[model samples]
Target: MPDLVAIASPGRRRQIIIRSAASCSPLGGALARAGILVLPAPPPGRREGSPAGEGTTNMGLQPPQGSCRGGVPWGAWGTVCTALCCADGLVYALGGMGPDTAPQAQVRVYEPRQDCWLSLPSMPTPCYGASTFLHGNKIYVLGGRQGKLPVTAFEAFDLEARTWTRHPSLPSRRAFAGCAMAEGSVFSLGGLQQPGPHNFYSRPHFVNTVETFDLEHGSWTKLPRGLRMRDKRADFVVGALGGHIVAVGGLGNQPCPLGSAEGFSLARRRWEVLPTMPTARCSCSSLQAGPRLFVIGGVAQGPSQAVEALCLRDGV
Candidate 1:
């Protein structure tokens, strides 16, 4: 087992001192005893979007001290749980729920050398709780929620052109789905969705669908059912690590947040479960920095201020 150490946090952040494997089980029982809510995922269609069940407050997370990695200036909109990506020598803050709980299309970029944010062209459709991934010089926005309704619009922003263009919208609507670019194509993984009148599922079900959009052919194809994720999860994190697409902690078919994680191998074409996250939480923010994936700010028991990172070298 990897060693668990307590590192002092900067600023107002508390030191997350998970001392030893003996004390901290893979189920994160230690965290649960410490006032962290590790409840299993509630039933589907119970109130939608949030995994906290109905009437439970959304984990409006604040970045822990030193969790933002390259000293990213606080976003102009003061948002939380937003998609922040670093590419082409700049940090991009895309659509996320503003501090006031409203969807925002605001796009801001931070130039490290200049130490300032420059407003870019806003997304054509404003949304919060959306996820963004970069391919080549463009940023793609996937499904997100707006006022309890899922936004199915799929749009991309060209870095050079500074404009948004609509691509093929998702075949079905979903919110808080996980997306990652691999082998020159973009992959949309599982997420929660409510049943639409015309839908095939006919009932709200946690999904394990895997759809890939080929940039070259400009077409979308759903992988076979056998190729779907082993776990039905949403509000998770997806990134390419060790040459494989890995899905981190999120809410699934349980009453509590899932600690289990998995990675998809193109060669093996199977989702292989990895070690569970030391801290089980949903709605956490994940960012790939160097050889590690930083998982920050999500709800475990309640709104969490804990931060943890999975060193990519472990998988490689």
Candidate 2:
């Protein structure tokens, strides 16, 4: 297998597509068999009309074109289970456990125009299974695990300011939870609090809790009902689309991950089921980009690179 890298110039836009061959390596072959396509990096120039003016530029060594998923390559080694978010056309990748099971603290940002990755200051604490979202010009990171230890600490990164600020802790410690931002508030739901590192996967203790933080009020509130209502599933991806908050995929005590997807309508105060994904996965990252919902890189029986795209208009 060739080490591939793709670089985009400061103001250029590129389309990246991943092609998998049957004879390719296990990872590549599996991806191709799954019918997944990685998206190219975001277009350059601060994503036109972004609230944050001319955001930061890419700073890392450029990988070869077509080597990474879509146009963005996983930095250095493939960092699966990492948290990702996009603000002002810049994509930010946060901590995840490496192949060695040790948590990584490196933070990398991608500039779509340049099609390059840049290094940023590391998180104060290393975390995996962390939930992240972007609001205004800031990226908010919430509860995750440090080697099986659930965390309640919350932090925010200011893109324009280029700094991180610690926020009030979550009401309860959690890891592998789903988080999303809507109407200037952050909603977190469904995660696990393992007893110890050795006991992490022994019995998956899932929560059905739902909590929200009002950015403007700087306070937290318990929602009317827990996310599950009765289902005991951990949520993987939480995102906002057209005034609705969607939660997709997670463990449900079944042998396989779930293809179930549900959404909360902020306008209606009700939960509705959307179209199920083609495959079942958990611990994946999801983002809404230009009228499409992209769910990327999750775990089924094992880590998967299956990327599924859904159109919001098709739902209603």
Compute the lDDT of residue 267 as modeled in candidate 1. Answer: 66
* Whole-model Cα lDDT of every candidate shown, in order: 0.65, 0.62
The parts of candidate 2 lying over 4 Å away from their true place are 1-80, 98-100, 111-118, 195-204, 226-230, 296-307, 313-316
In candidate 1, position 211 carries an lDDT of 88
Q: TM-scores across all candidates?
A: 0.70, 0.66
Compared with the true structure, what per-residue lDDT tens digits does model 2 show for residues 1-316? 1122122223322212111111122333333343332233332322222232343265343344324232334343345456666554455777777667887777788666655566777787777767776666777878877776787878988888878888878886666677777788888877774555455555547876778898888888877663442344675666677667777788876788988877777877777778898878875545355456767666777767676876665245
lDDT of 2: 0.62
Over 4 Å off, model 1: 1-75, 78-81, 98-100, 197-203, 312-316
Residue 64 of candidate 2: its Cα lDDT?
Answer: 43
Which candidate has the top score in TM-score?
A: 1
> Positional deviation of 67 in candidate 2, in angstroms?
22
lDDT, candidate 1, 13-110, per-residue tens: 12121211222234354444443322222322222222233432333433332232333323443554455555655656677777688888888765
